[model samples]
Target: MTSRAIADIRGAENLDDLYRVFNENHLTAGWHKKRSSLWPEPRTSFQPLNWRYAEAAEAMDRAGAWMSTEDAERRNLLMFNPVDDNDYDTVRTLVCAYQMIKPGEYARTHRHTANAMRLILDAEDGVFTVVNGIKLPMRAGDVLLTPNWHWHSHYNEGAANAYWIDVLDVPLVHRLEPMFCENLPGGHQEVTSVPDPEACPFVFGLERMRAELEQAPARADGTRRHRLDIDAHIPTVAVTYIDMPAGGRMAEPRTTASRILAVLSGAGAAQVGERRFEWTRGDVFCVPSWHAFEVQSASPALLLEVSDEPTLSKLGFFIRDPAQPK
Candidate 1:
């Protein structure tokens, strides 16, 4: 189309008029835009934000008093980004939420195409997640995975409430538009077996993870990290447990990967781009793509980090900023 025709199309007053002009001229709306699709750098609308577990715990207590498993599929509060009208995603390609289950309560069995996992923050004996007929006990510091399309349910048979952090690739699935979900025919599935912890491929038990972390050699900065491929069926996410000693500091180059970190234990401060988040046990935070970030521990800390690095790297979109001298 000519410049004048483009200008006319841009000036269309209504959606119907715009479509009419495009159809008449065999053009797309892309011609009306002045800005180039290609930009100099990565940009994102997601913000760097954090939520304190203390406040979430209080909210959970109030919710438990009024809400029940019968009322909803799960009792959880999302850590939604404070941007635009966004309510479903914590970041661009991932979402994290705090979930709680009261004693004797059961979250019904269901399965979806989106991969999911949980980081137990508070729980006692008798709390378990049954994934595909295997009942796996849930304890604080443990991580349990329920891959895409796997039947899963939660139950709290302990004396006190059970709390945990749930992270999923829901935003990615939503963007790709392959979402599918279904409730179990019955209310719950019968436990067919309880796999031994040593043989169970679906869990990273607390004690076992801790021992592995202790044995893993520390890097030059006195920090240790263990990587796990939590998504076995459809790999889209990666999980890492970082152990930082008191006074340890970690600085990483900016990368084109969105990430969420839940403070599993101890205290630390994170500087993401221009924002600072002081976090302790149970606190959660996000780092948007291409943001420079660093973490410093005031005390020895263990952190559970979830990121979309696998998806980006596999798609050949992953990149890291050039190294700079200190």
Candidate 2:
């Protein structure tokens, strides 16, 4: 690991002598390594996993019985990967959480270096998220952005509890060692303006997305996809909305991009590598990088997919099966 150690290890004469020198100098020889540094394909440490919405919702209900905004920052269940070392990440580069807010509760105001977004799973009319003083509505099937360092908080004024799927590039930030966070002086931020949901750049309403997907032609695999055009500023993540009709199936080509997908409507099943998952509305699942996947709609379904594709493409590390969609 050190230049001096490398220098000392190179002065040995024979194989045993070289290994002894390596041990003495605390060095490892590339030629004698037990494992190669490069591989023919990605071997991700994380595995494909799913977090059912029903289980999370039930947990949230139980938490709501005692936990409040005063007790925890967010009443949520983290979709942690079921890996030996991973405790917080849903995939290698992202962390997904199922968050719930009860009526008349606040999630407090804070911001971090991690870019984040939430897919509204079961929100009512009075649920809203305030980002940098702009209030945006949180309705079912809507996607709202809270980019890095933009102070944001959630509040529910509706009579019912609000639930949403939160996806963030926190694990990526944590790995990069540039993570930073801060809280507002007051727990809740003052809403300086309330923009029209139609014109607000931070809000992608369900109606508009559905309209666009309806007008788009289906792919050869019978799935219509719209690359949500809201990533002009957020560089780490790309969002896509896929619409599949009943019996429609998409055999996704293996790609070097890990993704977290949430079912926004109807029911579906997904095959990630050798694992299969049957999902309904609000269920979230992950597909690790380089895993072959297939999605089938038992009923007309809509999915919200979030991936690190933009980051990989920008870094020139992106690769996919030749059959991948354009």
How close is every model to the real structure, measured as TM-score?
Answer: 0.91, 0.93
Alpha carbon lDDT at 211, candidate 2: 94
Model 2 C-alpha lDDT per residue in residues 1-326, reported as the tens digit of each score: 57865676576567888787777766778889878999877788788888899999999999899889779998888999878877899999999999999999989999999999999989888999999999999988899999999999999999999999999999999999999999999788999999999898888889999999989998887889898776675889999999999999888788999999999998988999999989999999899999988999999999999999999999998899776664
Error of 2 at 268 (Å): 2.0
- Residue 185 of model 2 has an lDDT of 90
lDDT of 1 by residue, 1-326 (tens): 87976887789998877777777787657766547898988898888999999999999989889989889779999999977989879999999999999999999999999999999999999999999999999979988888999999999999999999999999999999999999999879999999896568888987888888898999988999888855465489999999999999988778999999999888989999899979999999999998888999999999989999999999999988766422
Model 2 TM-score (2 dp): 0.93
Error of 2 at 183 (Å): 1.3
User: For residue 195, what is the lDDT in candidate 2?
Assistant: 91
Please give the lDDT score at residue 251 for candidate 2.
Answer: 84
**Shift of residue 126 alpha carbon in model 1, Å:** 1.0
Q: What local lDDT does model 1 show for residue 231?
A: 49
Q: Which stretches of candidate 2 lie over 4 Å from their true place?
A: 1-26, 322-326
